[model samples]
Target: MFTRILTSALFAGAAAGLIAALLQLVFVQPVLLHAELYEGGELVHFGGDSTVPAEQDLGGLSPVRDGLSIVFTMMIYSGYALILVPLMALAQERGARIGARTGLIWGLCGFIVVHFAPGFTLAPEVPGVAAADVGLRQVWWFATVLAAAVALWLVAFGRGWAAWGPAVVLLAAPHLVGAPEPEVFTGPVPTEIGALFAARAFGVGMAAWVMLGGFAGHFWARETAGRDAAAQPA
Candidate 1:
């Protein structure tokens, strides 16, 4: 059973990751490239009380960088898939349906837990932007993710208001607790550019997660069907 699940996760995750990489190349990479210009001093938001021609930082989109980016995306998304598939298994045991359809919803829910929920306080950042300390941000992020995950599980699988009430509280906990804040909003990047970058990043993530969930669910169902047929008396 574990082997089946792992195999399904690998194949599905690789496919989804590749799809996500392509998406990031098209939609997300340009924003990152733009931000890096400011970070690297190639572009100055206000230079010498007037405008000046910024140096090209096109190297951000180079073939080497793109290649490494794809590799990293694949690794990260594969990890996500591994975590997601097991949750689907748990859902299955709880008498809930688990399939490509459910997977899409689950994927979106996962997005809410990991990205959307934490984003309220964190927002996406560019290289030159101010931020809270890395260690503190990470601690807060993990706590938020965990609270949201538990809340979602309760909403999905928990029995009654007794369960539901706690779930709501858990869902609200992170927002109430709040994320660490940056002391100053100092940065060379424009607010519009930063906002756009964050939106595109989330869009790319949603696409990849949808693909991962759909593929994992579809493949796992097929694997289960194959096993059942083999066991049935001929």
Candidate 2:
């Protein structure tokens, strides 16, 4: 079981990590860049002798920072996978029957609940800065999850196409509604930095959860199959 879980996690984690990276690079980066261009311009024009420092010219140091970031990110995802795989097993034991696809959905749902929803309120910013009010964000997150779960459940249990719609809706909803951008134009850090961070965080966290779910699903499937085979009259 441990071996199965580890193998499944590794495979799922790799795929999930790739997807997460793509999301950040494709969706999140563009949004943050646009926000930065818009808000930063305003700050420069209005602040009249702006006190904000120039963006950090990290130069060669960027590679180092990026490497460390990747290492830490992977570590976080791996840890998350370890925790989630067992939960998935327990869910399966309870007759949840969460296959690979459903596992992915469950993982994504978890991500939305933990990172994205909380982010709506926290509105990522520098440590000292006040985050935006999270109440509305929390509500939206809950609503979205409930809607998605119902849709997925209907599809999974009802054996219908309608469930796919909810899955699609779940995947696209976050991108459509978008995460909150930082309002205040702070120091050297670009305003869009916050948004970028939020997006990356969301993407990475979701990816981690998805990978974990996949692994869990695989383990469950294998274990169930083995049990059934063992019970069959030889």
Candidate 3:
């Protein structure tokens, strides 16, 4: 069982890392670049030189940032899997069955509870970097949560709650203890642009989380099956 859990976690972590990389390249990077351009305009508005590089670029966060991002992404996924595997194992021990659809719902529900719940809030923006103001972003957060809930409910075949409960608790525990305040980073960018950056960050982070859950759940199921098979053999 330990071996199976470890194997599943490794696979899920790798998948999460890969997805994070893709998201960073395809979605996050482009959004940041656009925000940078917007900030340049704002700088010019203030009669400051528009040539200053964006905080993301100027932070000298090149390859190191990329590596750290991947590491963190993997850690989040693996941690989730670790939290969930025991619950799943218990369910299996009790003869509960979970399908792919069920897992998807669980993933989505977990996403909503963790990301949209009022108990958890965004951290402060770093100095000199335009990022979203912490807390919910008006109606968008509500709307997005609603849409995602419906989508996940459908995809998870309505079993999301059962499969995701333990994982959700695990994820939220730290937040319940209190997350660090958002850092107040000064930026050459306008507040609007900072808000946009914050939104994008949330989107990307959530997307990665859901993808992580899905992959982890799938592999966990596989691991359980293998364990059961081994136990049944002569």
lDDT order of candidates, top first: 1, 3, 2
Q: Which is the leading candidate under lDDT?
A: 1
- Clash pairs, candidate 1, are none
lDDT of 3 by residue, 1-234 (tens): 688878876787678767866686566665566565655554332434445444533333367767786777777667766755565555556665654555565555655644654224543232355345535344434444444444433444436666466445544554464444435644665565557656666676677667766776788888767767988959
Residues 73-183 of candidate 1 have per-residue lDDT tens digits of 888888888898888887887777888898888888888888788886788776688888999999999998898899999888888998899999988888888888888
TM-score to true structure, per model: 0.92, 0.53, 0.58
Scored by Cα lDDT, where does model 3 land? 0.58
In order of listing, the candidates' clash counts read: 0, 1, 13
- lDDT (10s digit) by residue, model 2, range 82-115: 6566666666766777577777777876576556
Computed on alpha carbons, the lDDT of every model, listed in order, comes to: 0.84, 0.57, 0.58
Model 2 spans > 4 angstroms off: 1-7, 18-63, 126-190
Better of 1 and 3 by lDDT: 1
